[model samples]
Target: MSSSPAKPTSQHTSDHFRFHRPLAHLSGPFGNDSFALRAEAFARFFGTPLFLGAQTLIVVLWVGCNMAGLVHFDLYPFILLNLAFSLQSAYAAPLILLAQTRQAARDKAHADADAQHREALAVANETRLAAAALNSQQMLTLLQQNTELTEMTRQLTERIERLTVEMHERFVIHGSAP
Candidate 1:
């Protein structure tokens, strides 16, 4: 059985940003390739506690091993360790900058979309207000027409009663006097 996708309700449709067409492209800065994705992930991991802790542990072990004479790969100056740190910084600075640039672009896109959504809402509210005002005026006019009709009916009823009394006096009282 082929099932169609469920239709979005008003709640889902009202999310202007979620359905915004322009911001869809801005959702990812790194092109979908594995390398670009990996680079972005690596940049994100740089400031994490896990990354910092692992690096600290490795550095301590390296220094401890060298000082204790258990490994003499790079001795007093720790020149090799310093070189490794330099290489890491070289790669890290650019990747971090790239991530920051991507984030800035996404932020700008969201901000623009939000501004457009607000404008649309304001226009809709104004239209609704104008329609409500027009409806109120129409209702007022109908109430006035009803009031005028009721007054005319009351006057007609009073005039009929007066005419019936005058006719009764002319026929009954005049005929009795004769």
Candidate 2:
């Protein structure tokens, strides 16, 4: 239940084992809640196939328009288009890096949580096993005690029966019959 993983001890030995695989939480740092999350979302959008297709289409249109002489915006050297791509890369790099940093933080948090969970489980299992061992030992001791008590009771019963028979014989020998 603690926020961090517990260290292994001699009593709780299962803590030495690892059984959990922590997965990344990709809930996006900038969701609908804040601008930071939104910016991260927009930054990640560029990595998708949809963004690739859209960019390819725009490039084709730009080339076709220039070759057909329909637009004089970006001529032979395509200086304006090249400048636009440079500008896009300049902004894209940092935004993508920011989102990546957020993702890394989320992953670390998830990993820490999962480690704590595994520690709890291992401790529970070790406790159960220890309890079972103690119960087994107590049961054996009880059985042994029971056997000794039963033997003692039998001996006492046989002694009582012998004493009763002897007393009866002595009474018959020393007194008149009824």
Candidate 3:
């Protein structure tokens, strides 16, 4: 443990320590141990081109030295070299597996997030469609109400015109020049 506190990463969640996904160690439920992180980093480094090239160079030099009688170590059979390969494999396999497991977990998390996003988008679209339907209904009702109001206004105007004519007739009957 260092004097400083661990910083949280975006991918970290409340349950991050339960699973090792992307950035869980960077910022998660549990603070990462520096030594463990360093060891994992070192284990991952074995897969690089630099490591492969260096290993090849060492093997070639070892074989050449043994073949030329300059070095008698593991002569002809190269049992020591074979043992080194076996040892490397034993350690490398587990480290590689650890990295793979971590990567798989990270991929699963991304997939889950994508699924959640898609679901949320679908829900939003559904909500928008529902709102549109309600708006359409409201618009239809308003239009019907407007049509009814217009018809009532026309009927009222006709009735007023009939009344005025009746009043004019009554005034004529009384010999008024209206």
* Best lDDT among the predictions, by candidate number: 1
Candidate 3 matches the true fold with a TM-score of 0.71
The residue pairs found clashing in candidate 2 are: 30-37, 30-38
Which residue window of length 10 is worst by lDDT in model 3? 22-31
lDDT of 1 by residue, 1-178 (tens): 9999999998666753454776776655676678888888899899999999999999999999999999999897999999999999999999999889989988887888889888998999999999999999999999999999999999999999999988889889776543
Q: List the residue pairs that clash in candidate 1.
A: none
Q: Write the per-residue lDDT of candidate 3 for residues 1-178, one digit (tens) a residue.
A: 5598667876654763333444454431112578657757767689899999999999999999999999897898999999999999998888777777766776777677667767988999999999999999999999999999999999999999999998878787766764
| Pairwise lDDT winner, candidates 1 and 2 | 1
**Where is model 1 more than 4 Å wrong at Cα?**
1-17, 171-178
TM-score of model number 2:
0.74
Model 2 lDDT on a 0 to 1 scale: 0.81
Model 3, runs deviating above 4 Å: 1-31, 172-178
Report lDDT per candidate: 0.89, 0.81, 0.79
lDDT of 2 by residue, 23-53 (tens): 3234666444588766876797989999999
Better of 2 and 3 by lDDT: 2
